[model samples]
Target: MRDLQLYASEAQRYPPESVRNHMISNSIVPIARQFNEDMDALRGLLPTQTPCPLPARMAFVRNKKSLEGIIQRLDHRKIAATNIIARYNNGFHLLYLLANLSRLDGFRLHCNILSAADGIKALSVSQDALSQTLSRRHDALEAELQGQKAEVVEGLQYQGSKTSLALASLESRVHSQQQSLDELSSRMSSAVASPDVLGRMVRAELRQQLEPLLHRFADVSLLIDQIALGVSKKASEHSDFKTGGSGAIHGLSNPGSERRVIYTWVTTYRVRGSQDGYFRFRFVFMPRSWLCSTGISLVFSSGPDEFGHYSICPSILPIQIIPYSSPVWDIFERDDAFAVRQLVEHGKLGLRALTEFGQNLLRHAVHDNLPNICRYLLRDSGYGTLFLDDADMSMEIPWSLIADRSVEDDIESTREILQLLRAYSDSGDDSGNQSEWGWNNIFCSPCLSFEQKKSYGHLFLEFGATLRLFSWIRNDDMELNKSLLNFYLDTGGDPNQFAKTGIPPLLFALLLLSRGDIEPDISLVTILISAGADIYYIHDPDNDPDTARTTTDWAFALEVEDLWEAALEECGLDIASVYAESDRRLQDHRRLRGATRSGVDVESITEPGPSSELRRRAGQAGRRCEEGWIAE
Candidate 1:
């Protein structure tokens, strides 16, 4: 039984699924059967099927003591039964404990195996994913490095190309420079080799050419000196001839034996719109055989078809003779008186009208054969100097304006005079040698020097007063404004006359802008410009002062003022607010003047006309005059 028990315990310890039922039957069934049999014995009971009478069974169990003993035995049997129950209960408890322990150990082993398998699978998957990720990253990095290397290579190639181009250009330039240097060296060598001989030849030629010119110049000088000396002697002897000429005819030659008239020419033209007429007198030459006397001749033609008849008047005269009296002189005096009166009664408006009238009068004079006469004289006599008797009145006339009839005419006359003088002075030049002379030399050579010339004794006061009037204008002495106006009106002083510095009255007014004491007078500017002072005249930059070097009107105004406010009140821009405003204002002023001359009411026009429009109108007017649509 012990062995069986040990075997059973071992079987329980190593219970395989195949023998589980056998182990349970062998270990527990017998113990359960013994416990059941013991309980039955303690009960001492039989089934009803057993054949026994009830009375017989009662008799056998009679007597209290005997019954008590039987009871005791039954009691023992119950105790034994209780013992067996206790053992069975304890054994069942032990078996249950062992089975639960076995189940718990199996469960632990299964859990450990599952956990390790899962762990291994997870590690393997993670490693594979990690390797794929690393490979992809490495490929991307390698591609990026390769792209970078290609870009670097391309950049290096581009830089190399640029460097090569630059080197080629440098080499080409160096070669060109070397060639230029070689050529320059060759030229320098040749120049140095023959410089002395070339210089000697040039000097010799120049000296040979200059010798004849010098000799001729000396002869001309001597002739001029002799003429001047003879004139001075005559002037000294006949002092009355110099002082007596208030009218044009004051120095008329008295018929005398000492003077003989050579050739004379005269003509008369009736003044348009007046009863007056201009009488012209011309003398060709005077002989020294007439004891230094001069001849005067008067001639007139009855018609253009008739031969002109001439009359000679022998006269003792100075070299400079006063002009003869004529209806033209009388007209000039009347014009002067009218101008003075109008200026006193009115103002600059009157002066402007007078200026226009004077210009008309000059145009008429020039048109009526005065230019022709002057041209003939200049061409016939190779001397530019001519003396008019009425010096005071003649000075008042704008002779320059008359002389500037047309640019072509003036140029032709100037050329002819120059050629004639050159021919006379250098008659021996058969070599056709050409030499140039300045305008000043040709025109001023025969005229007396400014210092050597005598003043108009009777006209000195008037000239001084006129000069004083100019001074007053310069000094802004408005107190004598009326006197100055009167003087200007009477004398018709040239407002556009150039000063020694070549500045005109308009430019002088501009210069006055810098003077703090004098207000910039727009009215003065207007007057000067209306009187024909050229506002747009540009001074030679080389000769002009630094301030006057500014060429435009607006630029000049800007230089005069540092601020706009100051510029507003000064710089002759009273009607202007800004630089552009001043420019428009000046343009308007010029347009207005030009339009008025064309009989247009410029104030009624809103738009300022262009400068070319005015010039066109002037050209049209000139054409009309030439066509005799309007009388000169």
Candidate 2:
């Protein structure tokens, strides 16, 4: 009741618009009904005495019928009507006097009389009439000017000026426009006749030759778009793209230096036409973040007539135009060009309105293009090729596609393993003929490309190690594979060089063991153990741990727990017995070295002796020494 009294006092003192009367209700239905009733009563009392009541009032008045042919119309709502009534009631007498004076002014305007009311009213009436007439004339002039069109010329068109001296303005603006055009023309000419003309020509020829590549590129783009849409939808659902304060993950606008990447045109050209030909421009994306590697290149062709619309040229054709002699055409051919074409031509339905469509396309290309590219290198190219191409792709491609992915690093590591294999194979003269080489010699001679040798050595070692791991597990040649595993460990191959940032060889072996691909070869286990590979490195169940148990045999039978232990205990061949077997072979090596030093009978000592217990141990020790391993 006190609240009601205060509200009533407020409403009487202030216009309805100034006072917001609120009510509390027992229930929703009753409250709504009470509100309607109160609003109706307030609305009905508005026009009587409230029109000009307060300094601030909420009244909707439209000029329905003013002195000039204007009309005042007012909204007949409760608050608005009440406000109008209160304002009018407060100024009723003053308004009446003004109305009388207005009538005298109207009479004076026609009669030219000079009474007190007439003089003031006449001035107001004349000023209003003059202002209205001038405003109407200005509107008409503006409409006429807008309707006028400049005459079309056969050769040139002039830009009109706001001032009366339009011709002078046109001449001045034309000089600036011509200057810009001339500069651009000079650049285009210089680009055409560049010292690197061969490169430019090759790119052009490539565009024509690899017309199919462009199509494939388009197809790849579509696939990327589809994939991007999926990822974006998920990311967006999980995140926001709104622009806000810096580093606020919600908004994606400007993605800033961290998330946003800039793209530059790779090549630009103009195709001559009857009028103005199409301008073809190609953009290559480079992500700012050091983390992003794979970039994508896009071609956009537009015409003067098209204005904002541009024809997107998908992948350019595959051509060998670069300075490098060996072309990558074979690799691109092996990629799913047909599938890419299908994606661009027929797939990805509901993603037309996105401006970041190109970004999505690049993403799809990374997923689709990168794997295939890796496979080609693995099969036909060397590890070195992988490094060069991977670097190029990363540097040149758009990051938006693979911004969230780390698979490229794994691929790079794989390349490193392949390189290591080459090094291992090259270290020997047999050329992978022995059981030690594994069946196909995945890292053998075919990989010794001239270009590959020039590549980074560290990367090569990584590839060699990874490949060695894969081969070891795949062939399950445990006894024979021990040397390879030991080489990787002893050489200090990075233990954390895999996608999981851990040694992959161990995992591959363990996984193979788990799947029963091949029983952990006793010999392999022994070598790994001897080299200090953590056999007891138990893996968390959540994380895959592939480790084996092995102990080193440093010149002593007891120290070697793997192969040597089995031979000594299970085979009943004690250390003394093996030592006897290896004696003759050890003597032969000593004889050969002596003869070679003395420049006599080197060939005669080359023949090894028949197997003996002492000779076996000596031979084993000699082999270890040859491999740079000290037998303690």
lDDT (Cα, tens digit) per residue for candidate 1, span 159-207: 9999999978765664444334321111122222444454455345433
Per-residue lDDT, model 1, residue 482, is: 30
lDDT of each: 0.37, 0.35
- Model 1: lDDT equals 0.37
Q: What does candidate 2's lDDT look like per residue over 303-329, in tens digits?
A: 432245555545432111111122223
Worst 10 residues of 2 by lDDT: 243-252
The positional error of residue 583 in candidate 2, measured at the CA in angstroms, is 7.6
Q: What is the lDDT of residue 24 in candidate 2?
A: 20
What TM-score should be assigned to candidate 2? Answer: 0.21
